[model samples]
Target: MSALPGLDDCVHCGLCLPVCPTYAIDRRESQNPRGRIAALRAIEEGRSAPTPGLLRGLDDCLVCRACESACPSGISMEGLMMEHRSRTSDARSDGRTVAERWFLRAVVSSPGVLDRFLGVARLGRSLLPAALLPDTPGPSRLRPARAASPPAATSRLSTETKGRAVLLRGCIADRVQDRETRLAARLLSHFGFEVSISAPGCCGALQRHSGLVDLARELSLERARDLLSGEPDAIVVDSAGCGSALHEPLSDAPELHAVAERGTDTPSLLATIGLPPPPHPIPGPVVFAPPCHQSHGTRSTEATRSLLEHITEGEVVLLPGEEQCCGAAGTYFLRRPAKSRQLGERAKERWERGGRVKTLATGNPGCLLRWESLLRREPGVEVAHPVTLAARAYGLESEER
Candidate 1:
């Protein structure tokens, strides 16, 4: 075996140490980025073998790829982790991996099933055991359809509604997201574009992240065909993780390259088309938590940050752990609730120390839901996505029928 390509990219500068969520939580060398890289190198060189401890370390990883952002050498921790899991897929220690695989295929692979499953999960959340289900999603966790006081001034976007846009509502996204989905469509249409927002199958992100490479690849193709069928000028994704997955072109399907070529996060598109300053109605002291995939995958949260700051009149506060994962690395929260909660708490504590904020916003479904669960008890805080805020800035929310 090639022993996982790109293990040699680490210079051991230790920058990934502070940004790593698992490393920060467990304080384990074997769980850090460089440590994992070193372990793989040793295994390849025959100096070490896959022991129980080694496997356990890898299992604890969130694979959020914050290390990639912190790395000076541009080492892709996301790619490395996926490849490592694929190589060891057969040797998985427990049947839990099997259940995860089945869930991805049987339930999540289809848009319809995923919706029903999430619905049931939310309703029966209290009934489910802690180990199987993580935090209970508070009613306010998902962005409620509340519009801020109507914008004082009409927001400006391109007045010409000409281009076509296709919004890929990733499997779990449409069900849980409100502002990003309903508001995203309205925002795009308000921007003078013909927006297509509808049901969508998996993007293979969860599958690929879970080490089902072949399945992920297949799903990617299906998503490509569906996304491009509309001949969209822009394929927009409100979910950070789904958008990040399509950032890389699918080499196997040459036609699917357009999926990556045109696929963009909503903020990126809005920023590119020239987002004029919208009314700043959001109360001061708002915090923005950059989604792990949004920041790490794009390698910059500037577009989202810049747009957010402009909307809030530079009142946006960068969360202390803004660059760190929110502990919802896909399905990690569901399976490893304890670890996920602890990591979320670390970020929460750091956030609270800086003083309370009136609103908190993040761009991914997992991160949004996680925040809702974490901050449920804390009153007077609104958690939302930029699209929702954008809608308020543009006065679309008041126009809602």
Candidate 2:
């Protein structure tokens, strides 16, 4: 039997159990990191085959990597899990539906196609279920006027330019969260940074989590080439998931090392550049839900909090369960609706307990969408990226309706 790579890294210390969301939810050993690693070791040694139960154990994982943060052994849990998924072809097929596969392979991989489909989805939104439509019909102002332009070189250096960054207009972000994307660019530019918006299509984070490793690799390589073609000071990503995906180690494409090294979340980038005090500090408390990718995956929890604090004059409350997964691990909500809702409800309950807050800011698009679905009916409670709030504080009005 062949050895599973990185399986030996886990020392069975049980440190990951308490922080594991699935374990916290189910109280099952199989749902925890140590147990999952043990199971992977067993399979590698031919002690077990990939059974339905085993697959369920693996699929149920949020892959949020919170456990990795807690692990004392410094295990590369994400890499191990992805490698396992990549090796198990059957797992990929079983985890995703034909339609899901088509969407990732065809729709998401091409920005123009996805934009067209979303436009039609918007028209028929009233006819569709609440679950099918986005929390709000995206502002008409945000709809892409045309397909995203290709990744062409844009050298807009000025003596005043502090740095240069290329914005990743991800597939879903390009359509649904266009206002945030635009605001992020505006804010960066305001800070004396040259900003170039590029269509890298999708970052392949969704595909990797869905067990479509082949597609994930292909998309990663393509994005690496597109983003790294010309040297930029930073590759700015507003979505935590996209930023983390871009940061994933692409051993095959060593050329991308520089780009991956430069990849940063929007909030972190602002922190590095030094956020100027908001011209008009937004009134009332600002509650932040740090996405798992940002908090746990990238370890930018403190940096995110600092940025939020700098932008709002009111109390900046880090939501109590900031480290917990919001259950919107990319398409996890759509794939495992029951668990997703359970976790999202728990997160919302935590937010509610935090007292009256005017706005809720988070780093990931999926987290924003999930919260919007939950809070859209609540009235006056706005949810957005922290950078959006910062942009507003800097006197930039949202073009959003």
Candidate 3:
């Protein structure tokens, strides 16, 4: 419906060819970035509409932005797709079932509502038979919340130089993997910054990705304004996907422009600060499946790898492949379970081929959840976030006796 960034910037560059997972999957021009842009242009000019074929090319994209990074002319493939999503008909919105829409709206917009929902779900899970829970291939929607009290802080920051950092206590991580956030706070405080978990809610990355543009922008600006009052030195988001989304424009919020100017990912922040990781080794062999966002989307795997190498005993293996995606694209597993499973199996097979890796480390929460499900169902596999492993290795958490 609108003219995208002019196509002249693409230059028919073949540099992005080998890096595109869709192209690698089918070796079709239509599956690649250049062709997708062409199709978008044609659709805009009324040469064509959303055909199954044209939509396939656009939908196949993981929005990893690897092509943007690879481009000689600086094409913004991710930006283009986000725009396309806004202009496209609601009918084409992927997997936007009524239940999914309501679920996301309640959970993301209001943290209190989400917490209460979790309480109900947890109680239901306890009363219901295990068979009643959907045997989905992704992260189990039901994980028990911390019933007991949280641990007390062992130390405090100095009075003269008290600093604050707001953690994005994400919806998924807060409910399912809260321990990761706890570990993160410990690590940050160890490095001399007082950390506080941001009020529970979503950052609207999911809405943005799913073409809920107004929701995404609205929620983002609200979160930014709230966090700004805390006057944090930095907003440290541990989830790579959330962190990446925070880097983009915040719709039309003039107030948030200054605050968002300082957003930073955990790994990127660590790299900038040059924190010294302990000279210790993890107990077992570990392989990393860097989030497609960290690997291809943001290219921040170097920071992750460096941190891993610092505190591992056995060899740390980086699996060889396209590093395209794990297919747990946020709620992608729920929406496209079959395709997500295909990609997950492909990743698992590749990991096994590298000779029996005991643990798999990744940065994104979705990847952590999906991989956990894969490992739980499959015998003899362990998957966790890299930060969890790092926190343990650094002697931060007391190991269970």
Number of the top lDDT candidate: 1
lDDT of 2 by residue, 1-401 (tens): 33666687777889888888788789888888888988888788888998878877876788898988888888767777777766775535543555667777788878778777777766676566656654344344236534554322222223477787888877776665666777777777767777777763887888887667777877877787777666678988878887887787556577557667898867778787665567788775889888898876667778778878887777889887676787888777766778878888888788888884658988777887788777877879999788778777877654333
Stretches of model 2 off by over 4 angstroms after superposition: 91-97, 129-146, 149-159, 398-401
Which portions of model 1 show Cα errors greater than 4 Å? 126-134, 139-159, 399-401
Q: What TM-score does prediction 3 earn?
A: 0.85
* Model 1 worst lDDT run, 10 consecutive residues: 143-152
Positional deviation of 72 in candidate 1, in angstroms?
2.2
Q: Ranking under lDDT, best-scoring first?
A: 1, 2, 3
Across 112-205, the per-residue lDDT of candidate 1 in tens digits comes to 6776676666566646654454475643332222332221233335677658888876677755774467677777777777777644578888
Error of 2 at 209 (Å): 1.8
lDDT of 3 by residue, 1-401 (tens): 44677554667868888777667666889978889888888888888978978986786776766677677888878678777876773666454444456676776567667777777777776677655653242325445444333334644333333367777766666676677767777766666666776765677877777667788788777777766767888887777777777767656576456555677655556566565646455766788888876765556788888777777886888876636666678666665555566777776677768776778888777777667766675667778777777777767766311
- Provide the lowest-lDDT 10-residue window in model 2: 150-159
RMSD of each: 4.4, 3.4, 3.7
TM-score of 1: 0.90
If scored against the real structure, what TM-score would every candidate get?
A: 0.90, 0.90, 0.85
How much is the lDDT of residue 58 in candidate 2?
77
